[model samples]
Target chain A: MPQIAISADSYAAQFAAVKRTAPLAGPLASLRDDAFHCFDRLGFPTTRLEEWRFTNIAPIVEVPFQAPAASGGLDREVLDALPLPRSGAPEFVFVNGSFSPDLSDPSGLPPGVRVRSLAASAAGGAGGLDVLTAHLGRLARFQNHAFTALNTAFLRDGAVIEVDGGVVSERPIHLLFASSSAPAPVLSQPRVLIVAGAGSEVRIVESHAGAGDVPYLSNAVTEVSAADHAVVDHYTVVRQADAAYHVGNLAVRLGRASNFSSHTITAGGAIVRNEAGVVLGGEGGECTLNGLYLGNGRQLVDNQTTIDHAMPHCDSHELYKGILDGRSRAVFNGKIIVRLDAQKTDAKQSNKALLLSEDAQITTKPQLEIFADDVKCTHGATIGQLDPDALFYLRSRALSKAQARQLLIHAFAADLLGHIKVEAIRRGLDALLLERLPMSGE
Target chain B: MLEIRDLQAGAGERRILNGIDLVVNPGEVHAVMGPNGSGKSTLAGALAGRDGIEVTGGSATFKGQDLLDLDPEVRAREGLFLAFQYPVEIPGVNNAYLLKAALNEVRKHRGEPELDAMDFMTLARKRMSLLDMDDALLNRPVNDGFSGGEKKRNEIFQLAVLEPSLAILDETDSGLDIDALKTVAAGVNAMRSPERSLIVVTHYQRLLHYIVPDFVHVLYRGRIVKSGGKELALELEEKGYGWLDAEPAAATA
Candidate 1:
């Protein structure tokens, strides 16, 4: 077994134990073995790597986190504490990266939509085996990404969603995953696969939440494939524990004339890295990526997004915002790639960060690689503190200095939060953020 | 009532209000006229406790309390309002929300309970109607994408709602047309009472025609160069304030 050069201890034992605890069969077993070997060769990333220069994961790698015992049932503590969508629109719940049938409700799903556990679907049960094999590891760069390789090695059970051709689902599907790392620290790997047929419209809201303030690691991978003329709106909200590490990868592939928009909101974690890569593979396809991240205390929030325009007549738009207070730090790295054949492409990217304290820091990098001659690409990044004139305006209206600061901060967030369409989810997120914001010591 | 004793203030390195003295009693209107950069706005800003104005030596007493010692918000809650020359645009903060918060803070300071949304809306609608302002402006962000006339009218609407004891109009007529100026002046005139005072700072005599002042003071080079009754505004308007520049020794207080 090859050992990761960065870590003194080997993760081969954990892979073997995970296989013994929850084993796959046939092609699934082969896939897991391949992923395990890939992870063993690459290992945990360090700060020396260019992509990980600003993010260091030594604190997370040094910990000994074992895979939890096979999912017994839905964890009551997690179920009670989690603020699952009251929108009751076909919700699926997961505990420790494993799907829980008792908590998931797929009863009211429309006839054209299909929802299944990825593990069961991969095992040649409940049909659609060909689609599973064709797109399971299609987008995830497991060969280079250690965390994704680790997640794929332990890919036991996660949510799989499929939409038939020409079908439009008005109500969104909610996928909620809750990780519990109490008693002992454990690593949870959750994987999601979404496939949409031609001319179909679907929306998905995926939430990742940790239960307690215990030290744990959640490595997640989600792949989305939209067929020709398909429209997809996806949202990912991560509210992890302050003592936890959350690393998530989102890979989206768009077909001819498809429209895909994704909004990612990250609230808290010891260290959180969300990397999203979107490819416009077909002509006339459009992509939009919007993200908002909040950092307080000693937390570190990092967002790395890549948009690839490979075909002519494609457009992409991205806007990301970050709010940092206390001794926290944030990083925003946006890259846009236009292939040589992708002429007449238009892409706009903007990133803005608000620093609420002297110690809060942000590193923003925008990179555009354009090979096409006739393309319009623009990117802008701005970092600033609260507008003193706006604060004085509020204060001159009889508000206290603290009250003025709080109002201005809320106003700054309201512009981005207003983009959320779901009222219930928006309000729930507002409640979650209100308890944390106007962060103490500011 | 407001009293200023040799108020000296500066912006950055340049002194603006150099040893100025003024007294304003209740129910009286004082018009401060000046050419450009003659300390008209600086005097208003210093009285409102705005930043960037270092008060070198001055004592401003508002109703027996030292106004210069208070914070801007404290001065606001104490019923001192400055109608800004250039109203700031605060996107994402609704006008009604700002008004309600400001009104409640002022009311709370005066030992009065805050008005609920419904009650506050009724009061705001009444005040806005008096200014001929649109109700939709209250729902939009404060001064964001608002026209010049609309922004000025909104300021007067806020003045009517807050009902401060002393209202310092700092060039409120700078950007308004004749019709909007009439509406704003009418709104201010409606709030004129025996227990309230007004300090109208203007550059043109046209605004003073609509909202006539009881006293008019011509400011030149930071100090009050000339003080007189209402006729002085007409005299300065006819003379075009160039005489004050031509005659350096004609300074008066």
Candidate 2:
């Protein structure tokens, strides 16, 4: 393997360590080896690459992050202290990238629905491993993404879910990944694979958070496959520690007449990057992608999304909004691709950022590449501060200047909040966003 | 209840209001009439403590307190309201929510118990019917997508709800049809009480016919050069402001 000089020594040592301890054989082992080779060739991307132009990963590459040690003990208090609602849904908790059965509740799940740890299933050669192996690495390609390659190289444990055909899950499944402080900075790769059978409907809530003020790197990858006529609602909430680095990749494939929607809410992180790629593989498929990122202090948040219309009569809509305060920075890149054969394709994308301070910055790019003449595609972006006239109007209504600013900011974000269909998730996000609003000076 | 002494204010380098003087007591409606660029809106902005309209000279007192020394919201809490000539459109903020929040703020400042959502809704619905406003307007964004006349009527509807002690209607009659003008005038007339005062600032005498002003002052070149009873508005309307421009030197001297 050609060793790329960018953070070569640290990654090489880490890869060697993982290869020695990773319990894998047969095809999975070969998959890991291939992924490790790909990562070795590509290394950590620099700003020179167009995909990584806006977000710089120097901090992540310079640090040598060993695989986190197995969690020793379960902290019930920390788990309970999370701001999430107790909605009686089945929850799977993972600490330090290792599943903690004591902290997970798998009861109340209907028949034909399975929620289990990938490590457990892969080790025992369980029946679900067949489904896992078929769809895990199929959707998320590691050819161009260094982070995705790294995650696949170290993917030993994560949540694996499958719903049978024609079954509708009434309650959502919650996957909580909590990272605890370690003596040294650690790296955790949590892999998630979800497959909904034909005509099934399901909702999943995935959250990544830190236990305390510890610094860590969380590289996560999620692959979803929606069979013909299936519907899925997926929400990923990233509330990492202020000192944490988080990079997540989501790849989804939709079948004929299937519907898929994903909401990625990024509220906390020192440096965060969320990349989502959706493929309308079958005719009449529909996809909706919405995101909200709230940045304060010196945080840097980046969202990159791509929607590929590979078939005819497919539609996609995307909206991403950002609220930046202090000296924070944000980046949004949305790309919509309509293939030549994908006639009658409909797609729209919009990105808006509200800067609360003069120093806060945002960079947005919306691109549409249409190869078919019969397709209709539109994309636009906007960055601005609060409207002065709106502020004055609210002030005239007896709201203080700070109150007026807060209300307008809330209104800007409420448009995306309205897309969340889950009540508990919606309410939780609303309260959290309100609490995170920066206090204005009189 | 409201007093202004040689009030001089302007935005940036251009002075809009120069040495203006006016006074209005409780239960009285005073109409300040002048042609365009006569600083009519500047007078209203100065009274409501709008930003960018700097008070370069003189003072304004409402209920014995310096109104210019307070913030816009503080002035509002102190029972001073200015109906904007151009009501701003604030999208995504429900009209009922804005009115309820404003009412509660004013009540809280007076140490009175604030109204709950149910109580505020009941109160707002009553005033909405008074102004002949539709119930759907309350659920929409504040003045967003409303017609020009509806926006004007909404402003008066807010005034009725807040019940400020001193109301400065700044060109509230500028962009309204005759029927819509009558609705707004009736809403203002309904709010008139012995304990409250109104300053009707307009460029035309048509609105004065409905909400008849007790006193009419003709403001020329930044100063109120002529003060008379309600007939003064009629006289200016008949002869136009061209006559006042020639006699301003004599009036100022």
Query: Tens-digit lDDT track for model 2 on A358-406?
Result: 9889999987888989998988889999998788888888999988887
Per-residue lDDT value at A141 in model 1: 72
Q: Each candidate's TM vs. the true structure? A: 0.95, 0.96
Q: Write the per-residue lDDT of candidate 1 for residues A1-442, one digit (tens) a residue.
A: 1223534244677777778877776677788899988887777887889899999888888777777667835566667676554477598888888888888787678889998887678677667566677888788779898899888888788888999999998888989888888788878777899999999999999888776757889888999999999999988888777788999999999999999999898886788999999999999999999998888888888999999999999999999998899998999999999999999999999999999989999999999999999999999999999898888778889999888877777677776778778676688766655444623212
DockQ of each: 0.76, 0.73
lDDT for B11 in candidate 2 is: 91
Ten-residue stretch with the least lDDT total in model 1 chain A:
A1-10
Per the 3 Å backbone cut-off, how many clashing residue pairs does candidate 2 have?
A: 0
TM-score of chain B of each: 0.98, 0.98
TM-score for candidate 1, residues paired by index: 0.95
